[model samples]
Target: MEKNKISVTSDNIFPIIKKFLYSDQEVFLRELVSNATDAVLKLKTIVELGNFDDFIDDFKIKIIIDKKNKSIHIIDNGIGMTKEEIKKYINQIAFSGAEEFIKKYKTSNIIGHFGLGFYSSFIVSNQVQIFTKSYKKNASSIFWSCDGSTNFIIKEIEKKNRGTKIVLFLNEESKEFLEYNRILKLLQKYCKFMPITISLSSIEDKEKETIINNINPAWKINPLQLSDKNYLNFYHELYSHQLDDPLFWIHLNIDHPFNLTGILFFPKIEKRIDIQKERIHLYQNQVYITDNLEGIVADFLSLLRGVIDSPDIPLNVSRSHLQSDPSVKNISKYITRKVADKLDSMFRNHRKDFQNKWENIKIIVEYGMISTENFFVKAIKFFIFSTVNNVYFTLDEFKEKIKETQKNKEGKIVFLYSSDKEKQYSYIKEAKDRNYEILILNSPISVHLIQKLEFSYKEICFVRVDSDHIDKLINHKKEDKCYSELSETEKKNLKNIISSNLMENYKFSIKLENLSKKDYPFLIIVPEFLRRIKEMNSIGKEFFEKDKEKYYQLIVNTNHIFMKKILKETCEKKREKMIQEVLNLTLLSQNLLHGKNLTLFISEKLENLTKK
Candidate 1:
């Protein structure tokens, strides 16, 4: 037994550790539990090598809460500390800088990135007492005690245990640690994946010991050893409160450039962007690290659910350094690459299944492609475009299929899409009648992605099927025919009357086109470029705000009998009512009629029906 002062860089070390070294006071439990797990794992390795003679039959870490005494003890049956080992490892603060330590020992399997985790216990406790018995043959048991200062005492003690027990005397400010439920929650959050059996016991109920963690998680074992049922069961175990199951999972086993192992699950996401959250749990040798793995996993891919255990990820460092680290960037890139590869494989191998799951997985894929250029490049061949009829096609395949029919006059393929199937159903039908394929691009992000896709492809353009005249939607015509001037003049007057009946919020381009008499007389066409710019501005994207106003074309069919009858009506009041009704119907079909305008339209129609 010896009495001495702890070797540290400064006398103010205790204050720094208590206030600043760790942001969360609760992390002290994590640090202590992690150290216990490491000690157990180290003993296991030594036993495998036949170095330790006094072999323990069982190994586990136990947490005992004594509410009356205001003390919490973390007990572990592992390799205990000798006097010399304690003085060397515990007395001295690991102050030799991160770079020096990392250069000396590149392995992270030995404790945390910083070997100062033991001292973290000092952050929450007024005093800490350690009772230890070395596994070495004929070794004496020892007691080490320290208050929240540089002073510590080591002495020989009588003990029946073959391990170490750390008893923390909770400080006045940190008395919450003495609560059984508080300790239980922390254990479940950060220590749940530890590679040792962890249990909790209370002096109140001595017989029942509750085991809290699965020491051997499915991610830590050889993935080949697991079946699909096993994987799903583990997911349910990890996320029991979440009702929906994961769509699919990728068992990542990489040993080449860096050692990494984990399972990444594509979760069943709500068809909304706001509900996406980072559920990717990170671990180091089965010890929980951080859930906010922003730089380690791509921001968009962080929405996936599962576990990632990497001994090579330098997650124990400072936040700024972690964000800028080259290994972290590589890790981020590697994860996206692997995810892209997996998605590509699934898309190619089981297209039917992929399509079935596409609506659920589309958010991640589109978000990833928009957020990362590397993923977009790799995912080009795999980005599928599905039509309203449930038919799916890759970018190139869709283009080739439509090249002969949908090519424009300038030798460019014009891809027609609809934002709303029901509102744009008539336009879709018109395009379908002309043998033109229309894609369903209604996802909120699709507008941004389509704009980006157009930027990538100079020879292609995407126009909403309702954005232009049906004859011009495909640009199949190579010639133009002259029309009668008197008919054109009458169509101009009809356009003027229609425009006068509506609000001035919209910029209307009224034109007459040759069409079947059965076709509707009035059609609304929203231009693609203006509509996209306006949509971008709505989301605070950099675009012309003033140009964000709504604009559409009111196409009148002079060849249709209904249009000719409206133009040829003699009674001015009935003629004006007919024009207003026709224009309101067009606006309703475009989903642009709302509020007071819709109410007034409904009222006018009711009044006319009553009079008739």
Candidate 2:
């Protein structure tokens, strides 16, 4: 046995590595397994160059848990080092700094760009032993051991096998990793897509060995070779817990500028459904890196779930945290462009299917369009405008269909929409009767998106269906002489009587219209400006929330027979009661009446019926 101090610039490197270089104890296993993969890949390269004559078969990495002895072993059938090679590679630590090594092989697919990866063993173990045999001729087997300090032992051993075996005597703090389920989860997370076959014994079948990883995933293969079914199967395989299938997926591959490969799936997320916020798993050469890829993935893309493998996104020595660099921004922009292209293709080729899925997926797409300027610029053309009638249209199609009728005399194309169809049924019906199409924009971000459209879409404006009278919404046609107009004094008296009964918090204004007698006697209208401000307040806009109190327009139709009866009644009490009942019913239709008010209205309706 030959023992010596490790050749390093600092003697305290081991303590620093355990304390600073690595923080997550679970990464020790990842580092060991990745090193084994690197060793096999190195030998494979020699064979490809025709320098090595041996026919290599059965490449695999195995993880063994010896619970009784408090040790975990990572065994690999890969190229191993002899005595002299061990001294040069292991003893001379930090010879090639992790930063220098990674910069040299930044473009390569090799996982261990950092020489310090092997030292991560100190994170969870107090002592580690390595038994290895080199494949070279005249190479004797060797044993190397270190006790989480500067002192280490290297000795010649009589070994028959040609590979490396690492045994970690776990520290008391890291004994939790000995749990079968915990180790199994780490293996699934980090090594599920690694190139090498990982062998492990399962909890259910303790006697049998199982392959935990899929060596070849669909993202690495050509998109043309994969069918929709193939992609779907992969999706469910990656996310076994998810019950709903993805609406579609985009296979992203790029070699130039920067290396990036991924598959992003858009699940069926509707406005009514709570945003599950599927995280995008970011990887480096099939090794799991992180899912919190905020800087690398646009905020809006967090709704999409998938795997992104890119050697360009650099990580620190521990491979724990991602580095925020220019490459990250470049990759993010590329992904955004790729998603835009995919959506554009679907809209142009499979328009009907795109429309069918629009209502389910539009919230995310709209979010992307609103948050990302580049996405908006590229995807605006393919956006589908959905109507209350369940019909869909592209931005241009809807614009053309309504350009002649929906545009005001000021040349602003109006997009009339409703938040709740049930609550605003009377308003929507009135708009639809005049042959005007009402778009349904009811998502949480609808108000903000409408504000964004006002700026993005030149000479275009969006108004809620209940914002104003139908005649004012589309002023293209002349109003019909449906009923005689009421004088100013009569309108003033009508406003005063309504205000006396309604609560002060609800400020009501009176508007006179010559609508048909069959139309609603009174329609409650919330101005688009105030309603939009209220919407913003509900979603973290505290400045707008302070004044989000609601005020409404109570439009009285002069042509309605009941309005004439109330106006002509001689008994003040009877007239006031009739007016109050009509106002209460209007409020009820708008969902504005609550508890006591709603109960009183119901009681009044029953009493009037009994009197009749």
Candidate 3:
């Protein structure tokens, strides 16, 4: 037996490991189980290469909890290290710095890049012991024991099995690990479907038995051998509580460039922002590393629910390594492309089903497109827009159909919209009369999104239903004459009467137009540009929020009997009060008449009529 002291820069090393090495104490189970899985995989490879002749193939991991002794043992049948090998790999910390370690072992098949994984045991265990005999011929068994401190002891021991057994003396504060059910749950979370079988102590009827895991997960098996039913069975096993099945799935199996195998599922995305971390699980050699994979995968891919197992990921600096690695970027892009391709294929093969799922999937696709430009370019081809009238069309299809009809006088395509059908019913009716199609962009993000599209596409415009007069929406040159023209004095008097009767908060300007008698005597035209600007201000656009320059036009039919009567009444010195009454009526019709001015107008008209 050989002994060597652990090389540390300071006596503070153990303190650092105890207090600051890992974020959560529960993560200790993950690290220990992950190390065990790696060991089992290595031994399997060795056996496959004929390095271990006549070796027992019953290589199953086992977790046993002894509540009475306040201990738990995680045992694995793997390539157990010899005493000398343990001296090098276990006793001495190999890598002092992350960058140096990554560089040194860039080509190595080593699973744990950082030596701190073993130290994670100290989180839950006051004392730990390892008993093992290497698979090498005539190799002597060894027992290594350590307290939470740096001090440790190693000696030769007699053991029959060629594997390792890690016995953790659970700390008083962490006796939860010694519970039969608790350790079983932890094992399920960290090593449920590892390459080698994992077993937890269980009871069959009245007799004690071992509950073994399903070693060959769906991703590890041959896809050709699995039927559609097989893949669906695995999906149900993964998400038992989810009521609805996934829209589609991508079986990710890549060996070259980087060994990564997993299934990415496209669950029904009802809400765009509901896409969050923890959906993607990161694993190293079938040992779960983390589910909070912000830096590892692109933000948009967080909407994808699945597992990703690859030993190539750097464990020393998980976040920084993921952010800087070119291979990770490539892999992320590939996954995104695969997801997009699957969606497009689904749409092509099954139109009815695709349409049903489109509403639920639109949010995710739109979010991805808006965030990543590469995804945007790809997703736009498959994106379908549904109209307020329950008609669905792609962006290209809609543009082709409406390019001529919706084109404004300025030669820009006007995409008319309405936020509230009831509030803007009058405007919508007038637009429909002029044969204009209206879209319902009621989503909170629609305002900003439409603006983005306007900038992205040339000669495209969007306007709210109540934004402008019906005739001005899609202006066409017409040669017909309008309502009877009014003199300058008549127009001025009409403007003054209405303006004086309206509220201070509301501005009204009168415009004379020749129209048929059936037309409204007064049409309230909320100016297009100012209305949009005000809407933007209300939604917290700092630039236009406080700008006081607002324009609204009170367009009155000059030939209408009510307007003619008001003008004649205004010309009379004693009848000016009656004209004010008529002007108040017009303001009330526009929902603008209120407060002191309206009350005074009513009083003055009553007093004039009484005197007459």
Better of 2 and 3 by TM-score: 2
The pairs that clash in candidate 2 are none
Per-model TM-score, in order, reads: 0.91, 0.91, 0.80
- By lDDT, the better pick of 2 and 3 is 2
Cα lDDT, model 2, residue 209: 68
RMSD of each: 4.6, 4.5, 6.6
In terms of lDDT, the poorest run of 10 residues in model 2 is 96-105
Tell me the spans in candidate 2 whose CA falls farther than 4 Å from its real position.
Answer: 1-8, 95-107, 202-206, 272-277, 476-484, 504-519, 539-549, 558-570, 608-612
Cα lDDT tens digits for candidate 3, 380-451: 777776666767777778788788888787899888888767667777887777777787766535665576
Native-referenced Cα lDDT, model 3 = 0.70
lDDT of 1 by residue, 205-244 (tens): 6785778899788987787799999999889888878777
Candidate 2 C-alpha lDDT tens digits along 101-142? 346434265787767788888888889999999878778999
Pitting candidate 1 against candidate 2, the one with the higher lDDT is: 2
List lDDT for all candidates, in order: 0.78, 0.81, 0.70
Model 3 root mean square deviation, Cα atoms? 6.6
lDDT of 1: 0.78
